[model samples]
Target: MELKKKPTKKDNFVFLFKGSPLNDFLYPFKKAANQWVARYIIVTFAIIIRCAVGLGSYSGENQPPNFGDFEYNRHYMEIVTSLPLYQWYLQDLGNSNFMLKFPPLYAYHSFIWGIIGKLINKSWFELNNSIGCQDIDLKSFMRITVLFSELIAYIPSVIIYTRWMGRHYNKAPSIDQTIIAATILFLPDLAIIDHGHFQYNSFLLGIALIALNNLLYDNLALASIFFTLSICFNPMILYYSPIFFFYLLSLCFVPKFNLIRLIYIGVSVLLTFIVIFLPFIYSGGIQLLSHILYTTFPLNFNILHQSYPNFWSMTNHLLNNNIDLSNLKNLSIILTILAISPSCYAIFTNTSKRLLPWCLASCSLSFFLFSFLIDETSVLLPWMPVTLLLNEVDADVISMICWFFNTCLFSLMPLLKKDGLLLQYFVLGVLSNWLMGNLSWVRKFVNIIIPFISQRPNATPVLPHSYSWTATIISFYVTATIILSCDLLQIQPLVEIENFWEISNTFLSTISFGIFYVWLNFKIYTIHSLKAKSD
Candidate 1:
């Protein structure tokens, strides 16, 4: 027999026996702390760039220099210990104005942030809502608050990402995972909330991803709570119930299981369903989930109508009267059909190891297909990229596409916008927002808030001084370089990138990234296959 290499210190980890109770308890915490310390750069970068995108760029008020957090922040105050949750939730004013009230999950999240924000400024509410730059510049407070809150938000997700990385077969630690975690954890759309119109998705999205992971691992109770919480925030997750249900079916019927596994699966499903349905059930005391929640599937916000309150509406409104909802329905079906091609194959043929990736890919395709022909609901498209990133799997072309798009965004946005192409930016935002703002109600508020806040903040007038074409050129090049470096990473695709030219540039980069990723995947697969045969 060929000599087996001795286990090295590099491969030794706290989680070599992580399944044990002592190890599980210690490792997840230790891994979390380590990842927290090690991932400082990625996390910091994720927070700061997103902050600049808000502070340096503009807030939803597009108030050139304004970055207000909420409309009635004064009433509820920022998340602080002084206020009671009941008081925060029971508030009457900020609800519909910002659409923060409807989604139960996000309202709760805002409760937490409001408490923290209140503690920070004591009158951050006044600073945010009232028309005056407080003891600090609107820009500085705007940037600092977003950066600080987001940093606070990351505490839980780093824990989750560390657990995920530690779960890999070799129990390896990856900087790649840290980087991807940072991207998901510091979603620019949510991070920009303080900079513009942020709601509760920032930290909660991580919880959603964790819930998804737990569901696949057959941890139903926690997953159900998370999924429910996620849905409470965005409500669009209710659409994903079909995915979850089908997954439950596969777990129950498709997989052959031992008695314990079967018991585990059964309890997981029952507990998850009960937990997810718990809130509505308590309200009605016997609310029919099939009628109240499931019936609202394929939610119709005039999705077929071009004027259908899409992400692109603020930038430019279009009237496409000829289409019907049936058309959107048909289109989503066709797109779903397209998505199933590779995804179904991967799921059925790939080994158990591929389940997470397959599920994510399928969900992403369903979302994408829905966006493509569903009139103007396309703003939800960027979520496809974000959701796919959580899968933590990539191929050559996909990686290249991600990188190329990122490069194109910074390099391309100003050039195209300067040339009278707000439409292109709208499409990008539509897709980005759609993907990132997977929660519909959250998306709706942002759709209104960003533009609503576009005017100058009356309190402190910072004139709208976008980079002059010259300044833009210099700044954009620097931005493009940083983006290019990440593109080289290609952990997530460039749907997050800004404009058409950027997308085109990203497409070009994808061509290169695809080649490299393919080679790498091939090398790994070949080695694995050989090793398997040898064994």
Candidate 2:
């Protein structure tokens, strides 16, 4: 007969450390009343990981000529806090470069942080003189902001969402929910890019997740409010706007179109925009708001940046074999819309909560793969949905998620290398695979191959892999590793092309991501098909 483990105070503490010495070190917690010891431990571990990554090089660490996003964020702090509200968007700070292009919600956040920064060290956010100022204290302050915001906003929202999902699934074990929360909390790409590479994507992503959570609770009013907040914080989340719109509209179709709920949701969204933008609008009127909007959405920028691994980038490579891309931006938009519509439609008609994440992933991945001017970091958008789906512990789903996660990491590898995060990437890569239980077969295979390659017996795997899942994963990862090694080693270029390796890296990653995107859509379709048949 199978045995069921009885719950005890020590149980939570033991689970917290998974039998690590730390459990004995904190034995007092075993007797404590809180049943959430394991969860708190996971949260603490996640924070420690973020802090460790924060110790590494950040985006635009020392580039004197034009520092990257790190400086851009601090610059925004100075512009918004130092300048008048009317001049926030219109300022020529940083010599018309790194202008305050973000929406007012982000501007307000900067302003709040800027005030704190000025108190800590006035020079940190001082006008042009502070440009490229990589002050240690200031850098620490910036990292802390990202870390704290993630802890308070993103991590908590994910935990809450997962717990709610657990409850919805008929009281699944809290330990399972905690594990899912930790996985999402410690998503390597999100931590490395936002905390290490320097961005506020977590803040925006957190708000969006809360919005989704509210929708799950049937709190349409709160969902609209938070969704508006997300868009205001970062307009890039508009890629998800379609999914939320369709799902919320679908609600109207059911239970006979409740006009009051519809009006409440609409007005809530409308008022959020009005309140957030009122200061900008009042200071400079409609033209000012329009200017800010234009700044936020610079459609005129190149349709395909060299760093992005999207369809246009691959196509541009095929056309010109060079980084300077030329594409019909209008066509890219049309294609993105067409690609996203089916997923949105599926969600609108079916409206399964389980399918919501899949739909959002499809929409965001579609935008990331096909849309114009996608940033390398935009992978985090789709990652939110993928990570949320980790509650599904099926082996196939886990393997697929891991593959996509690795692909996302690989697509951002060049940027991560630029940030000097090679060590952190390796550690997190191995650790993530280990946690996911994706290591065994690859380790055995490595043992089998070591005798032939190194004339050594009983060799251990340097890293774990989901290699047994598919030959395609093995090939893709092997090629990616070779490409990454070449880039890291700065291998000699072919006589014909100066950036042959770089182009090859982008081309390979783009193709791989494109294949992953198609696979994801197929998975979503398969789920829909199963749901249909079951119904």
Best by lDDT: 2
Task: In model 2, state the lDDT of residue 281.
Answer: 83
Per-residue lDDT of candidate 1, residues 1-535 (tens digit) = 9999986533433222222222222234334645556466555555555654543333223332322343333233342134343333333333333212335444444456555565666555552244323434444544554456445544455545455644653344553344335435444334433334333334444556656667646576666567666666555544344455455444555546446645665575466556545665665544444444433333544443332222222112223234444566566567555544433433333334334433443444344334333322222223323333332332222333233234323333433333333343444434432332222334335657675533321110011123342343334346555554554465345635544233444333333323323333343345345645765
Q: Which residue segments of model 1 deviate by more than 4 Å?
A: 1-36, 57-59, 62-101, 115-199, 215-218, 238-243, 257-298, 304-321, 324-351, 371-398, 401-535
If scored against the real structure, what TM-score would every candidate get?
0.52, 0.88
Total backbone clashes of model 2?
A: 0
Q: How many backbone overlaps does candidate 1 show?
A: 37
Model 2 scores what on Cα lDDT?
A: 0.77
- Candidate 2, residues 166-200, lDDT tens digits: the string is 67842445555666676677668898898888999
